[model samples]
Target: MRGIPLQKTLWHLGVLWRKSPLALSPEARTGLWKMSAPASTFDIFLSHTWHTPGKWKILSLFFQSGWRFSFLGWFVGASLMLLASTHKLLPLFIPYRSNFDGATISCGAASRCLLGSLLGHGLGLLLSPYAPSACARRPLCFLDVASIHQTDRELMERGIYSIGGFLHVSKELQVLWSAPYLSRLWCIFELAAYRTANPSGRVVLSPLFVECGACICILGAYFAAFLFVFALPLQHFGIYVVYVVGLLPIYVLMHLLRRNILAKHQLFEGLRFFTLAEARCESDFDHDFIHTAIRAWYGSAEAFTAYVQGSLRQELLASKPTTIPLRYLVLLVGVPFGLSLDFLAALIAREAPMEWLLTEFLAGCLGFNLCWFFGSVQIALFLCDRFAAPWRGGLFDYLQTLVLFLIFFGVYFLGSLMASTSNLWHALAVASASLLFAIVTLVCRRAAVGS
Candidate 1:
């Protein structure tokens, strides 16, 4: 709404009020800064694990002091967190550990009561280089730093420069590592927002924040409401813990692997007929024979029909072959991650007292799965538009993503009716993941056509 001069003035005003943030009083600052957009991905990310820096010194001290548990804590915690943030949802499992009381948890390992805490700790470590410790102390301020790089030097030179000092040397790692860390940071921020704000808080937390909070709240309420809810007749506490802890790593690894690695690639090249190759195919067969060979490759009636139909459409214009970008991975991973986190937060909170019947717990789990599936669809849509075409990938396509929802419901309906509800929506969600892959294919193919 404001012109350059006005925006410049806002920046200047922000500079004048930078260090002594609480001085302006919260309301007036929020009111003035409302002119800016909400926190960007970067903002959320930094907040997620900003605590590591402060803890970093303490953690480093542990190592220096040669504490056995501290070393084990950092090592195991970092590895697990690296694994967990990628995949949020986990399957149920039972484990046996010599030290642990009963069956231990594992997505595939022993239960970690310290899983989230250690995750938070490890995340804090991974994030320590890019995220300043001071920021953790004043997390809400990230909303103001949404996209700021304006005072980087000043922040490091004068402000509590714990992480920033390291960042001075390795800007790339500092910048690159920020993504996943930022997300975790945002989760913490949401957690803080939930704690700090009133029940009637008008700020309106995003759906995940709202869902997670509500789920956590409802979960506790359910234990109080139903006598049988937490009065487990056939206890599977160990199995339950394993299931939950196992989930956290799956969440983390999925993001790291999918977003950081698998989802990114360079463009693929080469198309026949469209561009003449200097070297031609060395087949010495006749044109008719070659035609026969080509037909046989796509011999299926459906394949032939699709090929014919696709060939005729002017809309199917070819461009340069492109690779899926990290952004797509972010969508593929981030969307599902947020949704599943919401679901898990709900599920855990619900089962806290451990009294619910197995049947009800199962149903609750399934329903929450459905919720995550929907939320992920939103993320998938965002990725589609973000990677391929911004306009085409809008609310409409995202809304249309219900094809996936229906697909899962169809599977779940068929599955849960049988002996086990385990594979019920699982297949559909997997299929949807494939569908997302296909969308990526369509996008990259489109990019290829354009190029």
Candidate 2:
């Protein structure tokens, strides 16, 4: 079997991140294939589509492989937040003119200052403790574009015919699913062949939309941070205006969530009604070859189709729904949590009074930033489940979007109110309530999964 190192595969794919496999020159692809190590078995068989953007495949792989990229993301985000807090980078250009109770308050600058110092402390804590490394051995993956021949027709045909051999040897089949994956003949053939060859091997479905949803959550968090840093200075105009401005990010998030929901619905529906006859291939010769192979292996095309419709459908559906996994959630929550560190840093930097520190740390950082943002993501996940149902119509989707916006706005409004208050008890109350809501939503989701 032709196998490429995980690191090299990522490098080559990164080079072609914006382009499809067709964009690679035949000579370059042939060279990549030749450079691959010859192995009797592969650790992973990567099944993907050429039609989808390459970046999606890369992101899916990173998400599936491990937490290396996630940790890197947190490190980079925390570093940036620290810099912004210290005014070493990303200075708020907006003039601060808000004055309350005989004191001029530069909320924007103060927020940044606090964010930077808190990140600094966090970095210290992260480094000061000695923790064992959690890295795992990287798997050798058989990627079609690199493993199969691209230039010579004879070699290409041989490679295509030998795909079953590779799949048989692979311990795991990783399907990087996109919208077009189910309708493609070759994708279905690969999936069916792998299952037939290794009945006990793992089939890991890493849908592209789930990654997109996680990305949307992270982006929304950053957008919220932007509004907090810039809009807080506008409190002189009225807090309600800041709330209105906050709607922009929430609206964008809802729009993306709608797309994610549609994709997820299509995915499950496709699995339910998969038909080999309807699957398309670019070449009739390739189609005939696959059909012949299937008949030879399973005695008839109908039997193979039954296998796909019965066993494969159940297996794929048995995996988790479109809800973002816990790891991705951690990555998502880290965004605002990292930003909230600024509040702590600011408190320490100015040597503020104990009551001020308590208010900002408890109310601003934990309650408003961490707990409120966590609740917002839970709401998004819940809305995703609601809209994904087939019974929902376009009109209802629009109404739900509106409802989601209002719900997010209300949460933000309440968080802002609590964070602005000087009472530590109010901060504790808001934090407790939001945390409880997040936990309850999570529990209900788990129960739904169980049932």
Candidate 3:
């Protein structure tokens, strides 16, 4: 009788346990609900979230399917642009805060952006030929504006003293040499200190004048595009906008080419170097290392007669002038306006309306004129260098430059005369005029080199 009851009780307990597979506690049920709830917005990547390890695998699989065939196939470019604008790519090797007492001039604005770009693109300019990327863990940059402590007199003094060491060890020294740089006593000291420390070191000069011109050109292009988009009649605004959009990449290419031309043709404009201690009075800049060292050491003008002499020589020996090809000149002249002579000619022929062709011609004229102005400026700078002999430093150079202008003017006058009231001829004439000038300049340069 006792065995029969015990077997019956065990069967009942087994049946109840099978009915409730998991007899969870109330607290356990609540904890599970909380864990399974939706994640916060912060945890999502472009609205995809992973609450657990398995969910991460699911997300990855989903991403793999759609990664390649996306909008514009430029997702990587967009990502990079975003990263660059945020300055996430430029890791701060040395963290520094602005210590200037009056105003905060940190590299957050255009200066910072340009510096960051130079760091990435122009690292070779700053680095020695044999220098290894990882030989020094830290960036060997001396941001004088950003590095020193402003309030502490003792710290500032120490920073000033170490300026020489910084200049001495630096492979390249870049001087902005703007009005503010000239006015600041400390900034002048830094320049002087660099010369004192390294008589033979490479110094890169950032001429504000040329940089400003480039900036102005960029701003003007943007403004023109903007104005065209809004100021035009709404009937064909979309078409004009498309044209503007097409011109943007070309403008960038043109700007890069122009900069390369300037760098290749003229590095030291309105400046000079002298062989002996003495130089002409009107030379814009002269390098005298002994005088520089003396002035830096003593902070007095007693050791030097003239601050601006042609005695300062460029560290690098001048190389033979390389002849730029015709195709490059054509691109530099035409690319900025998205100009295709064949396309324009075909369009004019197909349209065959006086108003339309005239309009196009006028537009082409404007583009060609602007290109001519810029091209002439570049050629002028190039020629200015050729005429910048030590003996021809002062009034002689000024007179020679006038002659250069006369030559350009004469060419333009002759081209205009040839165009002479014919519409097609006029358009061709303007472009040929500018092209002719560039060609002649190049020819002259090549001849000079040959001699």
Q: Which of the numbered candidates is closest to the native, going by highest lDDT?
A: 2
Query: Cα lDDT of all candidates, in order?
Result: 0.30, 0.68, 0.36
RMSD of model 3, in Å?
27.2
Winning candidate number (TM-score)? 2
Q: Ten consecutive residues with minimal summed lDDT in candidate 3?
A: 1-10
Candidates 1 and 3 compared: the better one by TM-score is 3
Candidate 2, clashing residue pairs?
85-112, 85-116, 114-342, 114-346, 115-342, 118-345
TM-score ranking from best to worst?
Answer: 2, 3, 1
Weakest 10 consecutive residues of candidate 1 by summed lDDT: 267-276
Candidate 1 per-residue C-alpha lDDT over 6-38 given as tens digits, one digit per residue, 9 for 90 to 100: 112223223422342335555544444444343
lDDT of 3 by residue, 1-451 (tens): 0001111111222221121112445444333223222211111011111111222222222222222222112223333333443443433222111212233222221122222222322232122222343432222234322233334457555754566666665555654332233333344345556666767666555433333333333333334433432333334667667655655553443434333334433333323321123322222332343345546575655332233232332332123323333322331232223222222333332333554345334434332433454455356445444443423655664455456546644543453343333344455555566566555666675566555
TM-score of 3: 0.36
Residue 252 in candidate 2, Cα distance off native in Å: 2.4
Error of 1 at 85 (Å): 17
Kindly list the per-residue Cα lDDT of model 2 for residues 350-396, writing each as its tens digit. Answer: 44566666766676677767777676677667766666553466777
